[model samples]
Target: MCSASEGQSRRSPISTFSPGALRRVLRTADGVLVEAVYEPCTAGFEGNSPAAGGTAIVVAHGFTGSVDRPAVRRAARVFAQRAAVVTFSFRGHGRSGGRSTVGDREVLDLAAAVEWARSLGHPGVATVGFSMGGSVALRHAALHRGRTEARTDAVASVSAPARWYYRGTAPMRRLHWVVTRPTGRFVGRYGFRTRIHDRDWDPVPLSPVESVPLIAPTPLLVVHGDRDPYFPLDHPRMLAAAGAAELWLEPGMGHAENAADEPLLARLADWLVDAAARPRPAAPDAPRTA
Candidate 1:
């Protein structure tokens, strides 16, 4: 019953993991079993830390990234040193189900994963997402705003732009237009074998810029490299202009620095520690529908 393109685009299911990795498969709200990994807390979860009020952190990957991505795994390891860590592949990205909606359905995917992590008996939860995953984290906060009191404690978005509209004056802008338009067209017809939404859907309702106001007062940390080329420096500035979250513009770093730099990881671990110590604010007023 499948078309030639669909059949050709189907990826093989993932059935394994590396030696140090611990895998868990959980069904999503839409009945898809997503592949996730729980890198245990350093010194194990047995005795003192849980009693001492340590928090749990979840790491979400960038666009087309999976739990297996080096940056994601690295961030998990870094945070694992301080707290229990949970990381997962978004549906259709690695070992999960369905297809990519950029940040739309990915937010729901994150929500489902957050719920699963909470059910595992962790007292507090927070999420750190990179790039597209960062946008998804923001959307997740927006969608579930006040509901996270008993679940997620805070969220951090790394190198994620607030809008789909790229204002950078480089090959990156052209690259985005090409990917969101022509490349998406080609992928829809051939590569991924999935129906593509209209261009309007590509922006407006799903944009992080459009959704930033929804995440204010929820204890967000926005970190971006000063020299991130793919997403310009102005991106985080725009989010900060909204004045709802704390912003840290790393000096002279580029996108995906956490994966390659041990210091960044160390800094991130410290940041999470500090973020957990701070009291999170109440959710901002709800959005007005047109």
Candidate 2:
């Protein structure tokens, strides 16, 4: 946990730039320091690309994943072909501070990243997340709906669960153990370099299904694989049904970042760009005068 002085000092976002990447240690609302990287669009202004030069795509990685992970970097590179991209390590993962509340408090981390993206002057911002990050994306969009600086223009959740505490699958059961048991946490710290929180959620955060409905007016896409070992097809279906989101049930893909291929990543980038360009629904008319 950050001391009062340290937290106050980091209340504002701070950033630095390398040749092609902007690196930052963003402070979440809860005082956790999250590590993030921003890569400018590489394919600058191709013919008729809706997002041409004014959009930012925030990439949220899965559990045990970080900004430096190969999978996250690959996705960021692909997304940068269309829009400026920001990738961040959720708290407790990589160099970030604070313990993981799993998906509960992670929304604060995503919110800080989105605010940083907007601060960079991008007119539009979108979020694309996988697994644990996917859940954060949905919840953040819903929770921050009225907060202009923190809300996302569009959101895509890949391989996310509809509800929490799901232990139907073997992989999920193992993940629960990793989050619940002290020995499992030890393995996570030593083996995966991920630090798990010791306590359970005080009040369980809103589940993805519940959040989906609140994300309306902001486009939503839910992608899942038929062969996913962690979450079944029913997960995406539930999300799609709840929010009328675009759903893609992949054929042979398995799980999060590892299962996402280049082609799929490209498609997600295109969808985000197009979705950001889409006009929001018009407001209902006032009562007509006689």
Candidate 3:
């Protein structure tokens, strides 16, 4: 069920190319207003194929990214060819209200998006998240596992970190500086247009690897690039091992939405469509490392 503050505006379409696109302001569980756009499916695998017939995919952007970013829009366009797409701005980014908790409270933002997709009459809903968004997706699926209204039928995490507070790579070190320092926050605000919260996580929420074990039977996919500068190959491997998820280690891809090509996006759409149609298995007693 959508919150009372969640409302739709059909007056402004995303673009002329998308005739039935609707823009909305969704109120998250924590009362943050998130900006979202829904693009109806344009084409399908076959006429009224399952891939295009009943599924809606929610696309979560990386840190410093929003619904209007070129990479986000391009991804939505590609996925819309197979399924209706919902793209949203995380809190503290783009036009959304509130400050970013990075990956902590962002799960609430994703839950709201998933609920909004359900309210739109999509019987099957999947989530595809990149970078920080990927971490949020995994946690959202785990935290809201029992809530039918907020749970995802399928989930794909692209270029996500398996554990938190990692500073193994240069880009991650630079990111930490931008996230933890006053001067860095200023640059993130003015340069990236991202408003990060100053406070640290009091009690850190579940990490991606820990959360993965709780998402079994939901059809999880862990995708990462060998050449990703943000997170190394171990990140995806750890996630896949924990959840028994299907892993795809792309050879030349880089990181996040910027690195996902159209072919890969199309393949993901097909995977989500097929996965959502399958029956969910029983949860395992322990994490699957093999």
Candidate 4:
């Protein structure tokens, strides 16, 4: 177990953040303790109180990525400049303990983070996810649009796979090998510091494409790289069509959050902030006019 001081003292995305930011371990519904960092928005932009109107961005990292990874930290810092930020490792990654159910059970981890952000009294919250995290974000928004809890105001998915078991690309095939084979799981546990569950999806949870429409009344943005080696353009296209999501297909982009440039991330931040400001529909079934 990590002491509070160690978590606070740990290196982050440079000195961009103050030391007082909260470090916490949130437990999921099933009892997995998730390690997370929540940084309240600083003064540069505005508003700390919910009535004053500020949005919190809950960022989910890609596969093999953790809250402590440089990419995650950089994204968090950039978003923090404008809004509160919460970054956490999926179970089996980083300080969080558990076996990775790949993407199925990870939604609980994100749900915990979102609930935490809401608990801070930030009425509006947006979730930004990349790759595997992106898929999980979509599913979480669908399954728990927080009907009884605080709902996600907006969602942005970057370089996400629309469907499951897609082995169209070389990288994806290797990933399949890694997830299915015992040797691959062993290597993932030690080599990448990411633990993979050996078993396949029992019932097979909702696919990213299928999860999109369920988030209709909630603002959604799907961003993808044209040059992405993992998933082709078809993935985002499918997701956009089903969910009525706005798709931004970047020409020179590669794959995932790490490859995205600062300019793109900045635009994404603005979109989330704007989405948060917009009023949520009266009902979940209401079609998004915006």
Question: In candidate 4, which residue pairs clash?
Answer: none
Worst 10 residues of 4 by lDDT: 1-10
Give the number of the best model, judged by lDDT: 3
Looking at model 2, which ten-residue stretch has the lowest summed lDDT? Answer: 1-10
Q: Which scores better on lDDT, 1 or 2?
A: 2
Provide the RMSD of all predictions against the true structure, rounded to 1 decimal: 6.3, 8.4, 6.9, 5.8
* Ranking of predictions according to TM-score: 4, 3, 2, 1
> Across residues 57-132, which tens digit of lDDT does each residue of candidate 4 receive?
9998888888887667878878877788889999988889898877899988998898888888787889999999
The sequence of per-residue lDDT tens digits that candidate 1 reaches over residues 1-290 is 01121133334233322224457786765666677876557745563322234576788776556676555565666677777777898766666767656566676677667776676666567887887788877777676766553335677888887786565656455435434686654664355443333444533455777667777566778889886767877788887776578788888877752332667766766776667667755664343221
Reference-based lDDT, residue 50, model 4 = 31
In candidate 4 the C-alpha lDDT for residue 53 amounts to: 45
Whole-model lDDT per candidate: 0.64, 0.81, 0.82, 0.80
Model 2 lDDT tens row, 1-290: 10111111112223222236767899988788999987778774433223324889999888888787667777887888888889898998878999888899999999999999988888789999899999999998888766457878899999999999999987788888888999988977776777889998878888989989888888999999898888888899999999859999999988887688999999999999889778896322212110
Q: For model 4, what is the C-alpha lDDT against the true structure?
A: 0.80
Worst 10 residues of 3 by lDDT: 1-10
lDDT of 3 by residue, 1-290 (tens): 00001112112235632546778999987789999887778873333322334899999888888887777788888898888888999999889999988888888888888888888888889999999999999988787766458888899999999999999987888888889999988987887778899999988888999999888778899999898988888899999999679999999998888888999999999999888778865443432111
Model 1 Cα RMSD, Å?
6.3
